[model samples]
Target: MKLARLGSPGQERPVVVLEDAVLDLSSLTPDIDGSFLAGGGIDAVRDAVASGSLPVLEGADSLRVGAPVARPSAVVCIGMNYAAHAAESGSLPPERPVIFFKPPNTVVGPDDAVTLPRGSTKTDWEVELGIVVGRRTSYLDGPEQAMEHVAGFVVADDLSERTFQLEISGGQWSKGKAAAGFTPTGPWLVTPDEVDHRALGLRSWVNGEPRQDSSSRDMVFDVETILWDLSQYMVLEPGDLVLTGTPEGVALSGRFRYLTDGDVVELEVDGLGRQRHAVHAYEAAAR
Candidate 1:
């Protein structure tokens, strides 16, 4: 099932998507957050849908769509998990999964404006598949066990500022990745049963020109394995977001110019959804 949140930032209401129409789920749950998911929100929503208990959301089309889920506790990321993406960024595929974290506040709605950090010139884009966890998981035995913990998937744009990430930060990538609005996620959070996360077609474009064209099939460490690996070191909590790296064709590869003010980025993942973000200059007090 497709689930989403719609309204202004910080005031979104939960809704379920049925083809072209939207049904309000606010009567059943206040918001789709860690607590809600942990308490069997997906199952409850499914029952509500089957019992014809949810009401059609009025004027949902006019409201802004927020990230499918509320801010997660952590936004974990895998670095260069896609072999071709590693090659383009001038590196070899790693022997182990490279992990990093983007503070939860970095997440923003899919269509929001992305601010270019002051004095930055190498801002770039990455199209990634985001995994949302549904249960508390720790020290999972294997990939099969990891799959049982997944709640759904969403389209994630892992925007980066190259200078802060590679040259100026003394080697920690999160410095460049943790900027507000750097991670734009969702139009919907699609359940695992609705998507074949293993082989979806994922792509990205800037200013209407294609930049990245690849598939999830190219991932060096697929979803389940990455989750299994991460679970060994840290507990995967419900509503935790994991960005499973990007594929080849990004500006960091020296193929295209970095993003500038007014640039638009569009990303899409098969069976999940699409996102569009406009680049803008950073304002000191803007939230």
Candidate 2:
């Protein structure tokens, strides 16, 4: 099953996409929340689908979409989880996953404009696979157990402000990663049963030109390892999002140029869905 949030930012309503049609799950008995997916919520929705009791959403063409999950408790990101990306960034792959956080406010729906932050000049893009946790998990037994914790998957653009990321500041990378609207997530949140995580191919395009193109199989630390490692550090709760890291071919890879105002970035992953965003320069008074 594929879950989504539809309508304008701040006014988004939960939805489920099956084939070409969208279902307004908001009208159902179960409330729309992150835990819905993490805590056997998918099973309920599946039963509803089979029973034909779910509302078939019409006029969905008129509603704008937001991030699938309304408000994640935290957004965790993994750095250099892709060897080729690490190599391009002039660093070797880490022996263990490097973790960071992006404020939940950074989350936004797909197609929303990504505002370049003030006093920033090196904004860049990263297309990553985002895992949505379905339950509270601590010290997961192993990879298989870790997989069970995942509720679904979504496409995320880990938009970055590079200068603030590595320059003058000496703090964590989260500073550059947590800007508002920095994370463009979800046209759809596909359940694990509906898609094969290992076989999916992800690709990103900047202003209609392709940039990152790779498969989840290329991940140095796959989804299971990431979830397992993450649970070891802190409790993984429902609605927590984990960005598994971007594949090779980012601008930071040194093979292409960075983003500028009015540039549109597009990204997609097999079975999950696609996301698009327009880039604009930040104005101080605008924030």
Candidate 3:
């Protein structure tokens, strides 16, 4: 089943998207959030759909699509999970996950307009597979148990400013990654039963020209391992978002120019969904 939120930012209402209809989820719960996921929301939705308890929403295709889940308390990121991406960025493949973070506020709708950082010459894009945590997690006994804690998957874009990430402040990557709207997630949070996860096509484009073209099969640490490894060090609360890393062919590779004003980025993961972002130059004044 596919889940989404629709409407203006901060006012979006939860929904269940099927091939033929969009069902109102506001009747079941107020939002598609931590509490909902932790309290058998997906199961409830499935039962409601089977019982024909949901009302179909009209004109949903015309509304803005918000991230599939709301109020993500933590946005954890993995860097260099793709060996070729590590090579492009002048780094060797790490023996363990390279973790960082973007403040949760950075999460935005899949189609929202993003802004290139001011005075930035190295702003870039990453197309990643996103995992939404279903329950509180810490020190799992095995990697296989970690999948039980996964709520679903979403398509995610991890935007970065290379200078802030690599050339400044003692190499703190989050500095480049925390810009507003840097994380464009979802269009759909597809349940595990619907996805292979082990092998899926991942791709991206800049103004319709191809950039990254790879697969989740290329990830050094698969979903189960990533979550299990992460749990050993930090608690992944319900509704936390984990970005599993991007494949090769980013602007940072020097094969393509970094993003500038009016650039458009499009990304997708097989069966998850697609997202497009029209980027503008950053304004120094308050938004």
What would the TM-scores of all predictions be? Answer: 0.98, 0.95, 0.98
lDDT by residue (157-200, candidate 3, tens digit) is 99999999888938579989988889999999999999999998
Which runs of model 3 end up more than 4 angstroms from their true locations?
Answer: 284-287
* CA lDDT of each prediction against the hidden true structure: 0.93, 0.85, 0.94
Q: Best to worst by lDDT, what's the order?
A: 3, 1, 2
Predict model 1's lDDT versus the native: 0.93
Where in model 1 is the C-alpha error above 4 Å? 283-287
For model 3 the local lDDT of residue 210 reads 99
Instruction: Give the winner by lDDT: 2 or 3.
Output: 3
Segments in model 2 whose C-alpha atoms lie over 4 Å from true places: 29-31, 284-287
Candidate 3 overall lDDT versus native: 0.94
Candidate 3 least-lDDT 10 residues = 278-287
